[model samples]
Target: MKTDTIKRVLGYTAPYRLNLIAGFVCALLYVLFTLLGPVLIGRAIDQVFGPGNVNYQGVVFYLALLAVTVLLAAAFQWVLNVCTRNVSAWAANDLRRDAFAVLNRVPLKYIDGHSHGDIISRMVNDAELVAEGLLQGLTQLLPGVATILGTLCVMAVLNPFIALVVVLVTPVSIWFAGFVARRTDGFFRAQSAAQGKLSGYINEMVAGQSIVRSFGYEQRCFEEFDKISDELYETGLKSVFYSSITNPGTRFVNAIVYAAVAVFGALSAISGSISVGQLSCFLTYANQYTKPFNEVTGVLTQMQTALASAERLFAVLDAEPETPDAPDALEPKKCEGAVRVENVAFSYTPKVPLIENFHLDVKPGQRIAIVGPTGCGKTTLINLLMRFYDVREGAIYVDGNEIRTLKRNALRGMYGMVLQETWLKNATVRENIAYGKPDATLEEITAAAKAAYAHGFIKRLPQGYDTMIEPGGGNLSAGQKQLLCIARIMLCQPEMLILDEATSSIDTRTEMLIQQAFEKLIQGRTSFVVAHRLSTIQSADVILVMNAGRIVEQGTHASLLEKGGFYANLYNSQFAVE
Candidate 1:
């Protein structure tokens, strides 16, 4: 693991440090009591035939001591498990929460640039991996270390020659495990990344399954999925194979340490320097000393996986958040809705300029209709006005004050937007309608829904306004969803309105009704209407025709037609086709 990643992963445990400390203490006591079992058994062995007689009482007493040690060890081990489990669960929970918060705080550009599924994988799958790994580390590692150290102390005091032999052979186990760990580390990282990509691809396919079947893309989609799945398989197999070797490799080394102790210990016993029971204790101690190495190496795979996942999680946590509001930002209670765009320039990418030298001036309460072919900066202008993307040059002003100086939330609160893409939460029809004003009463919600001509359909549902809606309004028709969105904006009654192809999904008859509803909704409010059907906006007080990121013409419907300029050509072409 990288040093930085290790520090960061450990940081999550800092908040639960007390639990970790308690776990460590329990592990220490557990190991101490466990080591006592061997010593007491050795004593009992000596007592069985003490002084050429069967010392039954002495053996029974030591056996009782052995039982006590076993019970104590198990008790401490239980406490240790509880502490470690709590620490792991809490740490993982905090890590996941922080990852989610980062997603919300990051800029929309970041969201657009990354895969949504990949982000979700980092938050869910990767976090669980870290928790599992942490749990294994705590459960095995702390006790394993304590057992190894405690065994060494007992072994050295009982017989230093055998202890020397055990110590000399221990390094071989450590070195072997370390070598295998280094080799498997890269494969583990690759495996984690491949898993994320596979998850992303699966999410995209499942969410858009309808489009896939409609276009007969199942075969191609499966091929793509197979490719990603195969990559994950290859990396996973290699990492597991390499890490799997560490356990057996250390076990082989441990067997050597045990054999050497047996050989040397028996010689001392025969030489009358040590009792048979002492020799038996030395053999057990040698095995105990090497057990930790075997157990630690056994869990190496999980630890490597955890480290890989931690790196992925940290990548998201380290992402830069959206730009902060200006220190002296204004929070206007009400905006007059007068907007001006002065010599603005912007592009999603540095190399491709999408909007350049754009200028517009609109007085408060004027209904400005924007019309252009697709990709002519109509939506881009709206995005700029909402500060979704700030201008690269010049400035935008609302009510004669530069918008950059305004708080983002306050500025956005002043405008009611209804995009062509309708989004609804998993909530009741009433709750969805009152989304803009959460505290709205039923009467107010009904009034807004009635204005959008949605009240009739809503009343026809099984539960009327209380009917539950599925996510993305999947249970509702496209037009029904759009109507709910219009009702949402109507409830807000913002100072300004932005309707971007808002009624595109409705039928002609419903569109006429909505247009009438919008006439009342937009009255006395500064509304910017982006319409492709030119007839709907003929009554607009002013029409701004855009082309290639610039306003090519602007005038009233009659005056623009008389000019026979770009606006006239566009209006004539659209109507002629209709």
Candidate 2:
């Protein structure tokens, strides 16, 4: 799994392979120039030749050469930084794009089953972690490896015995870093999961803070939040503690190796097998080689955390998208609004059936009202109609064609939906009204707003149609937001409409006006209305009463009232209490 994640993360860099290659080349050049420093300094040391016997000219030449190498190394380092930054930015942008795209493509069931906050965390925090980790790996790991290999080769040519000493001790440090990494991997994974949970909780609390404060549940909310936060803190501390061990442990081993090299090189110098200047160069190479080990070990924490984040991110990317549109999917330009459901069955969970052997048929110009208590499958039926979730056992047809055979966009485009919840983007009132008809002119938008009884209120805004709506329509009243939503559907004038308690947020007077407008709008179009307010659907051509996912009564409102069946009881119970 880790290997697959690593490959996928690297795949995001495919578009920037040139940048990666350039960065690596620059990294190698930087290492090369840096390695020259030790050699030139050693040559200058040899020119010292005790004191009076020193070759001052030779010393000056090597020092000058060392200065030039330093300058070149600095230049390459700057270029390396630029290349890595470009590559990192491109890869991050691509990864985020794919992650977000997958979210849109995946089945709605996947979204309903997951926490919105957790999903956001994966898309935002986790993706960022992966990008940062990639940047650090590119900037540090590659050059560190190059430096180690370069030092080894240089040491071998200068003094073979000291070189052998370094090679033998290298594995100890490598093994220790690997051990620490393995031990910390699970903690990092736990930390990431905990963080996602915390994020999910926070998002829920913030979005529903009004309810929290109203119910005086802030103390309980805080207690739950504290629990999740404590879990995150514990896991994060463990991951940091274990990962932090790598650098110091490896450095301690490297320190021992450094001492050994010094001792061995000193003996070789005394035996006249190596010169003082050569011994100096060997010690420098020894330190240089072990330095990469320290650097690599230090990077292990970020790399492990990134891998954990990548795993979560990949889970999202790897989810099965909505079964792709069939190869020969139909894309009808117009829908007649005729729909049929045949022997349908569905369940959110296999052990608990929700809808079974359900069926419905509607003509092109009929109005069907569905009524039920909460959790009786009114919304589920609508979800099925919209293809948000497919029936498990049967099929639905629209305009004499199986819905699955039609391109989802084409099928959904035929219907305009307004739900109880009103959603408004942070845009001008005109834009919100024209959301369903992007190219709608100002006159068209104004007509729709007037039809929904929203024009009067909109004109009162400081900038009228151009006034920017605050996020979540915080600047607007609930009734006003719903009016805008109703205006959106009024502008679209789809072949069919689904109003799921669409006017629940609006005042009764505005709702009655909107209802009158809807009466004209649905004059020749098929429409489905899900309502608890039985009075609103009195004019529906057919009323279907539902219970436990099954349609238990079917008739017009007057006929159902005469039957005194489940529909009559529901209707009577509601008004009796009122």
Candidate 3:
């Protein structure tokens, strides 16, 4: 097990260390106040029942002192809780922010292999667990330890013989806690992993509901979901079972020790070896001692669960992200939208290249179309252009400078992209349209929406531009969502545009509207159009037909048909279908 994971968790609390220290000091003071109760009880016992005058005034005074002590302890506890809660909440927020920032920088490869549910679990559940650990662990450490130590010292001072018995039981309680913690930790880790799997299953099922229903796989999906849920249930039960054993077992052992201590103290008091007051104090201290031991056992068990979550969270945080920009990389200067790919080769995996020695030269304000069957590296080409993934070999240049030498942000900021699967957050229509340019005014957003042919329908909606979209834009039709995405891209006013099957899912009427919008958006920008619909790109200045990761044909529509190659065959097939 990596200890560093726990250390990193502690580091998040460094910013709030002063508050933690204040909380600790208050916890110690609270413990001191707690000790006063038993001391006052002992004094009352001596004055009222022992060989001493029954002084009512002293009794009243001690009672008043006891009440004051209780109030002060409560005050200290309240202050300690406030400090710890504030600090822990802040720490959790900071951890979440850092985790999200790291996730944004992680390579597409990492995201491709991980489910959204699993990633979300780390950000939500794991971060909350770490927060709980920070608050409860820090608050409990001082009070729990000080209570135990104060009780022990008072017991030893009041009567050494009984203190010896309490001391002997201490190690045995600790040992039991450790043994149970080890067992519970394994179960908790298994539970956390199972929870992730269950969450992933649910996310996939919801996202693919259409396919599932179309294929009549509802029963199969339920069966698979049930299997995951059952596994999670079993793992959760095991963790609960392991944790349950610690508290009862510790209490049982402490009960036996308590009985022995009571018997010994009674005999000593009767033999006149120790005063009744001292014996009473010893019993009070004995309960205090065993109380914290029991409490510690529970806290330790919880800590095991917390540590398990921390381990999983740190695993994600520690993962090496994709190659970062070089320290010497400079932000690219404004440039004409020219692009060049020189002998560029790329791959998702090292064993299989997606694009091999690909070469292309696009002049400023030129339009290029890329046509290929599904999964023939068409979208991969766009990904490389945006630096979502770096080329494995050769170089790509934007304007006249190598893309790698430009800061990734600067390189990507030059282009606007509209993907086939439009993503819209649950925000107002105006907010979604202005996503790329957050500071865009209402007039600017309206103009962009009008250009994308979305403004008319948007105005007809109940709340118009202020209407809140459902998750993934489920409130709108597929065409409407695509239009909103186009509007968002238009608002950015990028110098270059990438249309990755942006109109593939829309009807002919909607496609015509979008095509008009595309014409306006791409008028003076270098554009890359990746489409299966030959009609959409028939008028391109240059068309490249990719097959099996290489460009097998290149030309304008008329030129490509004269060559009688891949592009020619593709164009003929579409015409034949029409």
Candidate 4:
């Protein structure tokens, strides 16, 4: 709705100016030849009613010209469509590429807070709307404007009085279009929002169908879905109703304008101010002049909806991305993995801080185990260490260099991480293991898998290590997936490692193998292991016990057990459950 949004949409056509100009020129020439038809026909009419004998030869000559004009105009109209399509294709491609790239650059918080399905809808659905609108827009706008201007010029030249009547009547149709737009903008916007919500709900239902079935909540899920669907139906009705009325409304106004033009021109002819031939020409031009207004109005009606879609895409394109590194940002060739968190404070939202004045001093090559209850800021701490969110009150330093002053890639590249929720692309087992080190050889991949005790099960499969991983790793056992993740970190050989609830899903037998693999991988590398299972971290060089975003206790596992503090109570409780 903003002038700036319209300006930005039009600016996309600037790069294709030559194509647009050529299309406009073709459209103009087509309209010009179209206008010539009326002139030639008027001449033929005059030839039939002349003072002397009828001029059959002149009429044939004029008819031949008219036929040629029609054919030539058809060729240029084809050219116009081709040129406009080319312009629109390129602009759409540019928009899609930029819109997709914005996702990569935006802050993680944005992605976390918004629904993934709604984001996809904007990128795919709304963006497609904008593209289709651009195509329709260029086709209608350029030719429509040219035809209107050209027809008005011819009409004004032929009969100024009738042209005055047409120019005056034009505002009636314009006013109708304006009224439609005012009534339609809010509906289209609401319609788009409801559609996005429906898509998001559907996506959520599909992904969580297993939970629904397990909990006997099929009816409940359907009821929830129906609520969103009903909202979409209502909004869709309003949008369609308003948009559909535009064409008919403009057509009605156009009919009135044409009737006015005929009546006034008839009076002018009776008064002898305009000749009969000229009057015929004026009548023809009157229709020609107003038809473009009608087409333009229809296009505007369609654009009101498309502009809603464009606004969503533009919002994403304009969102604030991750914070940039300083002017003198560092990109170290290697890191020693000594991380220091100095007075860090952060929160996912305002007025509800999660971590405040948190500090840590980690020595290089030390294995630090983090143990805490759920929602006690354990994962949030790891997020901060990874620089997924910048600290508001303090700085995190890696290898004695401030992380904020280092390029994000350089800072994150030092550590290879595996979270509780494993991620495996739908690729071969070999490709999955070699994700971080893509160029690794088959022997190297096999060796890494062997270290994680995954090479045995992998080789027994139908395709051996070449077996394709299904989406969500649904084809593999949870343990097999965990081992593959471990193998990836082994191949990458990062200076630091983060294992968050890494062995939670593995069976006891596989957990032992995985822990052995972790011991080998953790050797001589600074590692942060977050776990609820106390037995897994008894051998950790240092144990950090956190609660409510601060470390309540910090020491070796044996030393903490001896002190019998909060960590002692947590350790005893877990063992009692076992």
* lDDT at residue 390 of model 4 (Cα atoms): 78
lDDT of 3: 0.86
Compute the lDDT of residue 76 as modeled in candidate 4: 91
Candidate 2, residues 430-471: lDDT per residue as tens digits?
Answer: 888998789999999999999989999999999999999998
For residues 1-578, what per-residue lDDT tens digits would candidate 4 score against the true structure?
45787888878879999998899999889888988988988888778865677899998999999999999999998999999888877887787788889899988998998888888888888877887788888888877888888888888887777778888988888888888788888888888888788788888878778888999989998998899899988987887887778888889988887888889988988998877777787778878877887776767656776788888888889989888777889999988889898998888887897888888999999999998888878998898888898788898999888888898888889989988888899999999999998999999999999887888899998899889999878898877898889889888989999999988888898889889888888899999999999999999999999988888999999999999999999999977863
Pairs of residues clashing in candidate 4: none
Q: Which segments of model 3 are wrong by more than 4 Å? A: 50-57
Candidate lDDT values, in order: 0.91, 0.91, 0.86, 0.86
TM agreement with the true structure for every prediction: 0.95, 0.98, 0.95, 0.93
Query: Worst lDDT window (10 residues) for model 1?
Result: 46-55
TM-score of 4: 0.93
lDDT of 4 at 566: 93
- Write down the TM-score for model 2: 0.98
Expressed as tens digits, the lDDT of each residue in 379-455 for candidate 1 is 98999999887889999999988988999999899999999989999999999999989999999999999999999
Quality of model 4 by C-alpha lDDT: 0.86
Better of 2 and 3 by lDDT: 2
- Residue 198 local lDDT, model 3: 82
- In candidate 4, how many Å is residue 311 off? 0.8
